[model samples]
Target: MMKSSATHYGSIAQFFHWCTAILVLVAFMYGPGGPEHRVYSPVHEFDRRLHETLGLSVCALTFVRLLWRTIYTRPEVPPASRLMVAMATAVQWMLYLLLLALPMTAVIGAWLEGHSVTLVAGWEIPPLFATSHDVGGAIASIHKWLGDAIMWLAGLHAFAALFHHVILKDEVLITMLPSWLTMGRARTGR
Candidate 1:
């Protein structure tokens, strides 16, 4: 059950997929910086903590997912047009790259700025340097820009999956759904 079968994703793969998706969404919502941030408020504090912890979790999960993926082949999706299949494959690759790159950039950016990633489990990652914030500003800028781009791409990925389900009337989306939900379902929505 841990390794994905030819027919559908295994439980572990599904778990990682959904968890990473949710974490990325939460992080994006709390990701804004500068003037948008309130210096001292519960919401702001919550945002900071959530972003830090969730980002870290995403990074860690991505590694596990990648390792699992490399060792195991993904489930065989139902037949679809070559174009659609290629599109899906490209989007997946982009997402995986983003999953790895974004968090690292953000983490290194924070470190360069002399800040610690206060992990939720009661540990803090120290800064990479003591007093050199020279590259922090640039890295921070890239982080924001790349973050926006990745969110847009994620939206497109979701839209494409829905397109395959609702418009194309395929199980491309269903196969990825949890077993309990996909039991008798043909596709997403009506």
Candidate 2:
């Protein structure tokens, strides 16, 4: 039940996939302060806290998902070119790496600035380093750049999914989608 099938993802895979996807989207939105990025500019303490919390959650979930991927045989992505399959695998690994590194960079940046990431009601996660404004600023810059890069990469990933559905006319997207949602597509072989 927890493992995936050759034709589609199982419930467990779907759960982690959708949960992480939603959280990642939320973290991205809050990470840059969304529409307020221009008007608000610098991230405020509250937003920073929320972003860190969400990022940490994403990191944890992604780790579990990676472990799951290893324990279970991956569902085949139908038939695709070798090059395309290789590229898809590479992109997936990159996303996993980014999901882990982004939070770590944020944590280091916070620590260097002499701060611990906290959630509502004072659930605090301490930093791994001591205060050093210079080091913090340098790390923060890398964090900012990497976060932006991930966002762009994520967009490309979304576009690719759409391409699979619209252009490729394959089950690539449906396999990851909920069974109920894809029922009609399956019956009609769409």
Candidate 3:
């Protein structure tokens, strides 16, 4: 049950998928948005640290997920248009790329701006790069844009899954659902 079968994703892959989604959402919520002064201000310190911690966790989990994907077989794609398949693959990779890039940009921008990368439990990573406020500001702006992009793309992904479940009446969404949930759905003829 830990490895994906031809018809469904494994429990492990499901766990990684849902957990990463939750972490990304929570991190986005905690992010201290606004100008640099406001973001690094003492008033937003806890939120900032929590956001960084979650972002870093997402980055690490993404790497593990990639490793898991390589080692385990994923469910075969259900019947769909070639365009749909291509879009799904593109979205998947974009999500992975965003997962890695978001945290890296945060760390790099903070370092370039001469700010410490603070995390939970008072852990801090001091600036490693030479101070370049202008460039750091630019990167930080991009990070914000990327954060918004991820949320929108994730929403689209969810919509596509729902489209498959309700409109297309396919197994695409069910394949990602927990076994118990899917079993209940089957029993109810839903």
Encode model 2's per-residue lDDT on 34-153: one tens digit a residue.
Answer: 232331234465666677789989999999998988888767877899997898888878888888888888778767866677764558877775689778767777777778888888
Predicted model with the maximum lDDT: 3
Show the colliding residue pairs in model 3.
none
TM-score for every candidate vs. truth? 0.86, 0.88, 0.98
Q: Candidate 2: where is the Cα deviation over 4 Å?
A: 32-43
Please write out the lDDT profile of model 3 over residues 1-190, one tens digit for every residue. Answer: 8889999999999999999999999999999999999999999999999999999999999999999999999999998899999999999999999999999999999998999999998999999879999999999999999999999999999999999999999999999988988887778888
Q: After superposing candidate 1, which stretches have Cα over 4 Å from the reference?
A: 35-43, 186-190
**Clash totals for all candidate models:** 0, 0, 0
Give the best candidate by TM-score: 3
Better of 2 and 3 by lDDT: 3
Instruction: Evaluate model 1: give its TM-score.
Output: 0.86
Residue 79, candidate 3: C-alpha displacement in angstroms: 0.5
Error of 1 at 183 (Å): 1.9
- Model 2 lDDT vs. the true structure? 0.78
